[model samples]
Target: MQPLVVLISTFTLIFVASYASLQPAETYWNSVLPNTPMPKTIQDRLMSGSVHDWGVSKIHPDICAFYIFFPLCIGSNIKAKDDPRRYIFLTESDLKLGTKKNLYLMKSSNNANFLPQKVDDLDASTSKNLTVAINLLLSHPTSAEAKDMRNTIDMCEAGEDNACATTLEAMLDFTTSRLGNNIDTLISEGDTEVKIQSYSISDLKIMKSKKSIVCHKLTYPYAVYKCHSMSDTRAYKVSMVNANGKKINVGVVCHIDTSRWSPKHLAFEVLNVKPGTIPVCHLVPGDSIAWVPNEL
Candidate 1:
């Protein structure tokens, strides 16, 4: 009994001295950076209840390995010493050819001192297709399309400087084209469902967690699209787990277009997807569960 009590006390002490003691992400930026200001957009991302561990590193003088919470997550990743940050702020305009990283807003007032680095594309097809799609939208688009494009570009600027979130906005139409209104129907069109490794959307596995956040960003595809001007999206509270196997609650948010339900008009139509059966893109509804534990 005595030993058990001591063990519990020690664990609590360690947690309080470590995770709880760390200040809000913005504090680190202010202490280490000159004239660091908090943009409302960045704050909105953080306040969404997702804080990613960006881990610490001495990669660059102007940069320490940190994160933008989940979207605007901040923190010193304490995992590997001197681990380099290979994070890329993915968005629609970032579809330029041949780059390790894609960034629309390279620097901003709030994160001026916290320089972000570049990394490789997640997939050539995704980037190339998205790039072509964005260009197409630029050519004589509808009033809404034009507004959407302008907003995405300006997302890099302050007040609403959240290029990552805007990236989702940019890709909203594309993902919708692929998934359409009934995601289950599209995924079931062929053996494509097997490739996804789960029949039920609930069974999908997560990224090979370098570490886990009890509740991670509802970073499902097309999820960011909900943040767009044309689409309707809202906040929903959810739970997730971290690398430590602890439970974490998070909010998943993204969509800007209305025909988000039509497959022909979603990602499929935007990417000009040809075919008999194309791969089913991830489509989490604005108010639905995007990701959850395998047990649930």
Candidate 2:
């Protein structure tokens, strides 16, 4: 009996440990992937830098140092607001280009007495521009403009001007509105159409004296509540009621069906409205209704 007791205790500890370690999986199946929009300002900055040869300095001492250190300094400051998950670090190519531009400015200055002063000024300006470009690119890495820039860079490296020109023209059309009015068009072209799930609410009950009611105990994957209308289906909004019958705005999450007219009840998990309070069910005039237990 003592050995059996010890065995049961060991099993209980294992069960508890496993249950405690369990975590909910990411809800990726229902999540929407964000769309990338072209950043005009960043593209313009890149174009300006390329045309003026802003950072074209010697490879060994000037350009290499600037490229290696400057981006690390500036990249640390860049951040995204809406989705922090979207931020990306600078690529090796981007770093190389930035370094080359800075080195060019350092080498081309003629004022020997003011060389340090001039370099400092140039560094400040370049830092600001770098920050803006990096932030915008990271924020919209998959944008049409970014893609075009990538392709153009590739073509130039491969010594194929004709192919680059063709790609650039398509990019020009995207910028000039030939592609469509908004970024949504570009996103839609690449993404699957998202379908909205709808549900019907059939039976509802409000307890006049109780503060809380159980709506439905669901083991289903997902649920939504909607009301039946002859003209069109409408979603039912839940509202809280004060003792004086005045409605108070509150957010409620529950699932119910309203399509059928019957006395059968749907059970919901326990909801805390308020202790000793009554619930009032508000529906269309012809809606079927039933009472829900406080505990499911």
Per-residue lDDT of candidate 2, residues 1-296 (tens digit):
00000111122232223211322111110121123233221122121112113221111121111111122221234422221111111111222211211000112111111011112222222122433433333345455433433332332233211111111122222222321222111100100121111112222222222111111111100110011112111122223232333332211212233234222221111121222232212221110111221221
Q: How many backbone clashes does candidate 1 have?
A: 38
Score candidate 2 by lDDT.
Answer: 0.20
* Model 2 worst lDDT run, 10 consecutive residues: 216-225
Per-model CA lDDT versus the true structure: 0.24, 0.20
Q: For model 1, what is the alpha-carbon lDDT of residue 20?
A: 34
Q: What is the C-alpha lDDT profile of model 1 across 60-104, one tens digit per residue?
A: 211221222222122344432222221211222222223122111
**Relative to the unseen true structure, what is the C-alpha lDDT of residue 176 in candidate 2, on a scale of 0 to 100?**
24
Candidate of highest lDDT:
1
TM-scores vs. true structure, each candidate? 0.19, 0.15
The prediction achieving the highest TM-score against the true structure is 1
Model 2 — TM-score against the truth? 0.15
